[model samples]
Target chain A: MIRHHLSDALLMGYSAGQLPEAFNLVVASHISMCDECRARLASFDAVGGALLDASVDDLGESDAAVPESSLAATMARIRAAGPVERTRPQVAPRRGLLPAPLSRYVGGDLDAIRWKPVGGGVRQAILPTDKAASARLLFIPAGAAVPDHGHRGTELTLVLQGAFSDASERFGPGDLEIATAADEHSPVAEQGMDCICLAATDAPLKFNTLLPRMLQPFLRI
Target chain B: MVRSESVTRADKPGEASVSKLVGKDEMNGTAEWVAEMLLVASNSDEAAFAHLFGHFGPRVKAFLIKSGTEPAVAEECMQEVMATVWQKAHMFDPARASVATWIFTIARNRRIDILRRSRRPEPEDLPWGPEPEADPADAVSLQQESRILGEALKDLPDKQRELIEKAYFGDMTHGEIARVTGLPLGTIKSRIRLALEKLRQSMT
Candidate 1:
């Protein structure tokens, strides 16, 4: 069981569809690993559904956007989807710990990724998401220390494999370590296993060193 | 004619917390009705689907509009959302959630997927993933949890509830909520945090 689970607030953001894609990816993947959170999310989803029920029907501006033939249009879309196909989820993970939700981004599993070195023996592949935020698959060799940095905004780093010890805690698979302006620490990969994490950041890192600052512009991370 | 009593109970001054007072048995029946309708729809039963569409579509459109999406976009998104619900009907498990909750979740996620589709220009099935597998717990237990959550939401003070709505239903960030409500960011955070924490305790 993952000790540090996503909070109800964050999960609410997720079920409400308010979370950025990066955080969404992290939460989705974590839910796949953590059943407790998954169940909790179901509760949140139920709450969302009930709220929708309680919401009064107002044929307001948004309702004006719908064509009178919306039901017909929906039926048309379903018919176009074909009759006999077993619902193949658009983004299916053929097989891996990546889970189906995160796999679609990388196009495949761990081996499919073509990682590039980002200094300090750490390698990263920036996953294409959106301008609102950036997501990447990061790899840290055993015993390597990530450059100490503070977050300018929000950063969610979810461990996919192995473990890493930050300033105060060791994060293992399914553990998501969130960092904000208030927290800054060098996350060091524990010895005996390589640490792989799916990291997402809404803003650039506030690095303490001169070298990292200079490279930030070119790296666009 | 099968209306939701729990929904109306919110306004029934005497039933300030009808969600808690209502036993699991009454809710289980409601949960099953929607589930069966979805199951029938999955088999291409038009009448059942139309029933769901009639109930959920307008609400979904209103929700999107409230969340700040353009009216046309909300309507368009609502259609797409209902379409997915129709196609994915077989996936709905009442054991995990009530039908209203499931449909609401689909609309919310579909809205997100549509928004992202514009930003990343990629054909993706997002807001899309397999629904969670049913927990080992009995069906009644799941319904009970849902009831608790619904009541927990009702028990929140009106101001807190408003902020929670903006947070979840309006899909606004803390900053966006602060801007709209004209309150300090910290106050916004506390209200929502306390509300959610209450929900958390209720679940436990």
Candidate 2:
């Protein structure tokens, strides 16, 4: 069972389409693995639906109106776009290690990643996202430890393969760990298998070590 | 704690006069809209599409404008949203979402694209093989629940409702939602959570 899930704030932000691209990616990747959160996200979307319906009724009481030509113009655009061939929603099989949304960013699964050694036994591949935030896939060998650090802003780390444990708790595959500015910890990979994580952060990590801090500028972590 | 509020809303719909709020006519209209979407999907019926536009077009336009979009751009975005409704009608699953809910999602994405100019990554679509038609009973029950939820929103206090509206209108951030609303996010979340549980039970 997945112990950790997306917070109400993050889920609602995603449902509202307000989160940064990197955060959105992490939220989507987590949902791809956790159905409970998927259902919860649907509930949030339903609220948006409720508001949209209410606004229509409010429009009659208020002064807002659609221009008279709006329908004709929209129909014209539809015609210009030409015929659309209807197709059923296709099934997207999960590629190994990565979910569909994450895979799209990496262009494929584990082997597709272009890994760069970040010292220690840890490697990372930064996924392209908007400037507001950053997302990267971290690969930690079995029994390896990520350096101790604190978050400058909110950080979301989803274990996609294997498991990891920090001072707080253990996070297995499909589990998400949400750390805020107040949190600081060192995470070590479990002994049985290598741990691969999709992690996103709004601000850079506050590394405790001088070496990692020096490499931070070059690594863009 | 928020779960308690949702239970109250679900168990005591009559206190809010939710039945009266939805009204018979509104319930019928919901079903009618679903049928029209099916017509668009199966027959590519222009008349049905026009009917949908006549009802939802102004609302979508207003939604865009409220979210800080310029009037001219809002008009254009509304057009694209409607066109997309036509193109993706085949994907509509009444068992999962009402027409308004589906349209709201499309509009929300459009708002992000225009207002934020950033990508909005969606959860992977649930993988399923060739499927049978969605059960009509499931669809009807789900739509009924949606109307009840809409009525419940109308019953919220003005401050609470406005806070919720601001979030949807893109005027509030996620962190601000709990702070500005004063009431815990759980209250709103629990309310929606009830609806989700019902939806899951029906699907099963």
TM-score leader: 2
lDDT of 1 by residue, B30-95 (tens): 444444444343446675577667767777887777666787788778888887777777665545
Interface RMSD of each: 7.3, 2.8
- Candidate 2 residue lDDT tens string, B1-204: 322332233234322122223434454556667767776776687877888887788788878887888878978999999999999988887666778889999999999888765598887886433444355655666677667667777888898888788888866655685454332233334444454455446445
Q: Give me the candidate number with maximum lDDT.
A: 2
* Residue A117 accuracy (lDDT) in model 2: 94
Evaluated at residue B139, the lDDT of candidate 2 is 62
Give me the displacement of residue A151 in model 1, in angstroms.
1.4
* DockQ in order: 0.26, 0.40
Q: What is the overall TM-score of model 2 with all chains considered together?
A: 0.87
TM-score of 1: 0.75
Q: Chain B, candidate 2: TM?
A: 0.75
lDDT per residue for candidate 2 within A95-117, as digits (tens), equals 58888899999999899999999
Instruction: Considering chain A alone, report the TM-score of candidate 1 relative to the true chain A.
Output: 0.86
Alpha carbon lDDT of residue B161, candidate 2?
A: 82
Provide the fnat value for model 2, as a fraction from 0 to 1.
0.64
